[model samples]
Target: MNANEVLLDAFGRIHEAVAATLQGIDGDSLSRRPAGTGNSIAWLIWHLSRVEDAQVASAGGLDQVWTSQGFAGRFDLPLSQRDTGYGHSSSQVDAVQARPELLLDYYDAVHRQTVEYLQTLGDDDFDRVVDTRWDPPVTLGVRLVSTVADCLQHVGQAAYAKGLGRKPD
Candidate 1:
């Protein structure tokens, strides 16, 4: 398989994990934090989707699905449109609550945009530098890989938190 195919496969795995983690979870369970300071399953999925949407869309020179697709309105989240859950305080995390379907819809929308963007890239496109802040700079391929890695980590976290039950009041 070519590089694009390989990359797509990696992203596909992340999507599968996300779906499995979210399956059968009710809104209450999704909003529950395993520990007082920990993130909830809902927050994990929402953050992952936002990160992927923002990072991938920026790399592709496209508007983020979050705003472009009206998810911000649908979610009506307390945070600003630019919020991607980075360094979110516990209060901010607690502000994120949604039904499982809405959470999955956002994730699926972001994933669709990600896959569509990836499909447009030629082999050489992957070599294009997308970030210069890093010491050696980062390529489009590397950036996409990083996105996948971050999403996978969050998916795993959600899965773990899903099993931990709600934090005691």
Candidate 2:
């Protein structure tokens, strides 16, 4: 398979996991914090989606779905427009409250935008650097792969939290 196809499949897995984990979850379950301290299912999914949205948008030189597509207003969280849940505190995590439908809607929107941007890239595009802040710089391909890994991790945590039901309070 080609680079683009690999990325598509990777992102598809994230969406599948999210859908499976949130299939029958109610609002209370979604916002419940694991062990009463960890990230909630809602926060995990929302943060991952936000990160993906920002990363893909930056790579494509496009507007983030969170702001351009109206997700920021829809989410209505008490965080900055550019906040992606990085370094978020417990209060910030609790601020993100949503039902499964809203979470899915936002994630699906960002995913569609990401897929469209990725489909426009060719093999050669992967070699193009997208960031210079790192010591060796970052390539479009590396950034995308990093984003996939991060999203999978967060989604996995959400799935575990959903299944654990050990201390979601």
lDDT of 1 by residue, 105-148 (tens): 99899989888988887899998998999979999988988988
Colliding pairs, model 2: none
Residues 1-169, model 2: lDDT tens digits: 9999999999999989988888989888898898899999999999999999999999889999899989899888899999999999889999999889989999999999988998998999999999999979999999999999999999999999988764557
Candidate that scores best on lDDT: 2
What lDDT does the true structure give each of the candidates? 0.90, 0.93
Clashes of each: 0, 0
The segments of candidate 2 whose C-alpha lies over 4 angstroms from its true place after superposition are 166-169
Cα deviation at 37, candidate 2, in Å, is: 0.5
Tell me the TM-score of each prediction against the true structure.
Answer: 0.94, 0.96
Q: Which candidate number would show the highest TM-score if scored against the true structure?
A: 2
